[model samples]
Target: MTTETGFTNVDHEFFHRELDAFLPDRIYDAHAHMWKRDWASFTLGADIQNVGIAEYDRAIAEIHGDRPTETLFLSFATPDHLDLIDEANAWTADQIKGRPACRGHFFITPQQDPEWVRDEVKRLGLHGLKCYHTFADCSPTWEASIPDYLPEPFVAVANDEGWTITLHMVKSRAIADPDNLHWIQKYCRSYPDMQLILAHSARGFQPAHNLEGLGKLAGIDNLWFDTSANCEPIAHQAILRLIGPDRLMYGSDLPVSHARGRSLGASDSFIWLYEETPVWGEKHIRIEPVMVGLEHLRSVKWACWSERLTDQQVEDLFWNNAARLFRLDT
Candidate 1:
């Protein structure tokens, strides 16, 4: 093992019994989306899930080896589809009713008035709201603002309710300034009360993109970031360093990538991920020691893939903080 971070030959078997308990009693996958039967839910990548709610449950059981006591669902829609807010919100809320750990987020857009969303939010037991930052659409309420299309009313409701929101957070030609995340901040400065979750660890703490903004986020108290789709090293570390533990949450953009992705392939992916389960508590690394490392292991073959953190830190990122943040009853 190299001294740098303790080298290990990691493969997909990296996801076994060790991670089985990292979540303690349970957890909340802070950033996730469910595609309804009407339209296949899609993340930014080429990956698409023809499967709907059931698939998410299977992912919680097999991949996480634990069901999320709650999952904050993001609306995976482009600008054109933003008007269907109520339908999308209802679909996710129904899924939540079916699963204990499920909650919905409105990908609020200015394309329509925020009153529809405000009304919907009141009807649903929502945990957060999502804003599409790259939208090129006209607001029914106000002028276009950074972080894209959210109109004044949507932000107003979020600011009033003390609810959490995640900006689409993709660095874009339209959104050249990450500090527009500051837009949420700018408004919150006046409200001094609303909460917002910047997605993708604010594009992985890129200095030009968002680190400064993340650093500044601490001042807002209401602004926080989620590690959704951010399993890479620099992103995690930057967040751990800047935002600290309480604000972070576990989010695997699952089915977005093979629930198990190994350069090797499906079978190897599983074998490599769950390698520790087959043996007794003693092995090359010792089951107990590596078991401590399990959550880190399951967090994506970080050993060979990326060594930005230690096994214990991963355990914290993967489940502990999530449990705390969501106040998962489990």
Candidate 2:
């Protein structure tokens, strides 16, 4: 699968030898991002300037081998370029157009007019919205206050439109923070029309935090969890057990998930790179790393398989569940 960027599927022989037999025929990646470098604000280094649909296609081909797949492009939210939201959404929607298997979600902020959002959703036929809490509307302190987590105006627009929100939970313990969990519960209950897909299994950076949060919120009908760039198998297994197969979906968080640098062998290469930078006038620091793995999508499959999920359960995780959520069948 070659594209304009001279992007071709790379050799992922290691992934094949490990999990080929265990994987399904195809996958529906519920979470991914795609855009030209100039159109976006974030950077992963000069060598990795762009990650358009071509790059994504090549990478997924390498990861899945010969298996076919579908992906939903979630508009990336950057802290510095809040103004890029419309442009980012337009870029994604344009790139994935005419490809039924591919769809895109736009990014939104409460700062924007809700009526404009309603019109844009109808005009673009967008699948959903990718909400970056810390960047869009929240102050990223050690502990977030629930009363002011997300903008109520944007929440109302999404609910009125009956749109899905792909939320990356913020705060100290990711999703486990008491205030964060309470905010999620409030949103889910208050906005019955809105569907919420918690990214990274509610940011299971620590498996224990993930389990704790999942235990508290698993029964919510409108809530779903995506296994996107989550590296821990223990947390993934816990997600399956607590949230059940119907509420779990496949997500790669690609390009970000694409393994980079020299081979540190199979096992070692699976580990992603992390850079720690001082922040808050050196009072605190951010160690945000692009979650990478040679087999991120496969890792999710491996987790499901290890838990002895039936073929039907695997089907739901990789395809049907996302299909139902995003109305992909239509």
Candidate 3:
């Protein structure tokens, strides 16, 4: 792989040192996933599984090396975990051991019998709900993953129950079509009181060409996006400017692109958000690694975030906002 596009290899000295030295008492990483099973298949084309409990422990040791108070886990299972919603939540609950940072969004769909799994949802201490376009061979719109099913009262229940909803919102076929807007339109209209967090900054850093669809959804007040992998200039900057910081949250999509056997990569994209591109604008823009540090909260963004924002703002993003939104330990 070209050094320009391959995974970065930096001591990230400043970030590590700063995070280790200036530990926050209430910080919480909102977008990382936690699973204890072998997640090799999720690695896709990667050379290795890239994540596992051991590696996660090491990663937790490395980033949280300072050991922040808590972290809100975006619990998930492999594609294999989709169909068995009740089982998926049960597995993740065991993984969490019933803690906030160890928490997660239970997968939900209306297609099958649902199994609803209310008992498991309660037992698992589910923090929120997660829905993906790829699950059950489906799309976020009214389309069916099963070719005979649809997302319905299931979605309404999640909204009514006041569970945070995170949707994997950017892609090619599933996202770039008319069906893509259906859910947002339906959810925003149906559950006017719902809190919907869009995964990736309304679709990661879309160039000018792909901005319209994201922009349309921005009209919905219930719609929010996670900075998990939106560190790159395209969606990162645009979302900040267009969607505003209030609508954004930090996310690493951890281990997916990194080559771990359990967790996902720090991000699927944004490989160039900090390294090669000093600034992420048409020509010139402020390129603050600190902002990146604050956003990712684990890797190099720490040093940059410390330098860019006041100590309080850093704490706000790392802890306050997440605590208030997820109702986590403050």
Candidate 4:
């Protein structure tokens, strides 16, 4: 099941067989990350350590083969390393400087100054801002009563610049949580000019959560959702049925999602290139390296195909939507 291309699972083959092709003309990856090796100690785990620009590009090429693809790079969310927000943002700026196909989103801590964020975005030519309220143990706890992570100043700056905000929601129930829903509604109404992208269908890992959340937010025109790290079929079905393809964008959530192989429809940890799964065959059967990021890419492709989307819809999800949102076409 392993190939020299760095994929472990047969899913990629399955995708090709099902779709009658293994590659698309182009892939506008809406979500991806890169980090400095020195920041390893600050990372949440060893699997994510040593992930930098080179590794990120390798993962993308390994997944899509020779097909052309573009990446929108977001800094790795480091809750414990909030002090490194400026440094992380700067690092991303440096990584994408000459890479025309790549765009970077700077990270903003809850305590960051709005003027500073606005200044930094202009200084680094950042296309957007990323807000992570709950990603790790050091991340802020999700509560209905908590204040907006992006304060008024940051919101104002985003609106003024027409920049997108990629939000990874906090809380167990995700977008279905009453408190989160309330906040999103308020934010969308208050800042209609700002383009809001809800990561992972608002993190709707379960069917019911997807239904309730996407259904509730269907009326918000400014709100968009990205297919990043979300592999649930039912949620994707709901996304198409509820919000339509125009607002649905593609994201691989690379590096973190690519550090190892994962069992489909399971919460298992990343299996390294050298690790073996007994279920596959003999004990310690060395498994071929599988690019988990490709798993995400293939999964989204399957989602679009499953929905019986038109060619235009597929193009919109994978390319046009993200391009328009990020102003990449220009």
Candidate 5:
């Protein structure tokens, strides 16, 4: 029952039954990616090679239907493609220009000069910064400290400009890790103007990390989170209950959204089950996995339901919160 677009009959049914009525009419995707295929050092499928505004619109429609969508488009570049960083960031700026509702973030590396980074962001008209752990000069970069990639200098510039930073932090224990907590606290406390968005529910693929650490992060006014590609109900539920819905935003994590799989919390960590994952089923029955986007929507619905959030609160997660943060016209 898989369609030409990669969604299946199961996906449609899940959407209509579990998500259609629950979703608001407007959406502001707070953490989607945009990149050129050729710029990638690794291989990209033809379907996602040219993921600019147009491709993003079509991809989001598959999940959001006819809802009008705005986005915070993150420029995509990996450590392998560091040489093309400027070109990739410029392309992001070009794609989002003239689209007032949308905004873009300049991809930055730790090695770049802080002054140059600030000027480049201003020149490109980008609203903020997007950084990843891969750029850290450490073996097994997953465990690298936050400062290794997103350095203090870059943060100072963001604070000066009142820019937002979408950070996908990595460590074995995620937000609960002592080093992660220290840097996050230092940055937000020292620079009140810079808004810090903890992407993927603070990388809470393991909900325990959120439950264990979120209590320590309370009362930070400039901190926020985006539910990007995370399918754990408790990870988001914890945020709603602890941080309030005003600080939580919905993110499709597109391209990954198009993939057929769901991320699951396993023991102290988490694992992703993809279409090719052999554990989809056993001898008793078979299962057809839906799109990750559908699974993510369902998770958000469950979190809202568990927290008994009002419709207005739900709207805030999907749209209003982002609008308020970006100062976009509603």
Candidate 6:
């Protein structure tokens, strides 16, 4: 049976059978989000409305059990709700108060003054910045270029402050696009102190793109990747093999992680299969999908197995890597 929060018997079984043994004793969630419902332009369900640090802890416990878990909380707000960015970021900062092991990122838009953003991040005591393509001034944001949304002025502030920027890049070809590679290399090379984290396995939902592009991104020490809700094994496997596990950290992608579905790599693209997707059954057989978080963990397990990573290396993927990046005492 599934709970109101979306955890189900299927997820429990999947976790115990496939993930319990593979997970480390401590987990550092490098990516997750928190916000108030009123701050969003879109309607949020009562279950997810007003999600704060406490609520996040409760939701994650369904998957993490009693194991100690810390998070790098991201501020959440859609493009239409730009007016609420300050409140949303304030909420995130408040949620992480007193939780030294945890950190938060200020949500940024391209139009904001760079000086204001830098001062705001310091005022909120946030560690980094989070930028999305939806805020870009483009017709179809999915295909927007890096600088279209994440302006250089903001990146310069991050570089000066030595802050991390969690970037969710967009394009039809993901990282394989020449423009994407050029911009990524430019920021990391020019801003040696600022760190750039590519979310969703470098947006490698389509593993073929990662396989084709990750090798080209080699030798950049400041570039990192987070395995956040990307269910394809090859996506994570390629990063581990080509980039090394030390530069890869774990990210739950929270609310999405609780969703019941998985992302499948299609021909040069990817598709998300939800619980209501009609392809789950055929003839007399039925397929029951677990939570995306569980599927994500399973994918990590498969990738580690394929890469023959040691237990310590696996721990680094789950915890140590992020700890070292955030300068958290272990």
Q: TM per model?
A: 0.67, 0.82, 0.66, 0.82, 0.96, 0.97
Using alpha carbons, what is the TM-score of model 3? 0.66
TM-score, structure 2 vs. true: 0.82
> What's the residue-level lDDT of 47 in candidate 5?
50
Question: Which candidate model has the greater lDDT, 2 or 6?
Answer: 6
- Alpha carbon lDDT at 263, candidate 4: 27
lDDT score, candidate 2: 0.69
Q: Identify the candidate with maximal lDDT.
A: 5
**Candidate 2 stretches greater than 4 Å from native:** 1-11, 41-49, 134-149, 261-291
Task: Give per-residue CA lDDT, model 5, range 13-112, as digits (tens).
Answer: 9889988899998999999987777666322233556777887787688899899999999988877666888999999999999799898989998988
The lDDT per prediction is 0.53, 0.69, 0.51, 0.69, 0.90, 0.89
- lDDT by residue (37-60, candidate 1, tens digit) is 354444322333334576666544
lDDT of prediction 3 = 0.51
Q: Which residue pairs clash in candidate 6? A: none
Full-model lDDT, candidate 6: 0.89
**Over 4 Å off, model 3:** 1-9, 12-26, 38-57, 64-69, 79-87, 137-150, 173-178, 205-211, 260-314
> What's the lDDT for residue 117 in model 2?
75
lDDT of 4 by residue, 273-296 (tens): 312544445476844444455555
| RMSD (Å) of each candidate, 1 decimal | 10.3, 6.9, 7.9, 4.7, 1.6, 1.6
How many residue-pair clashes does candidate 4 contain? 1
- In terms of lDDT, the poorest run of 10 residues in model 6 is 40-49
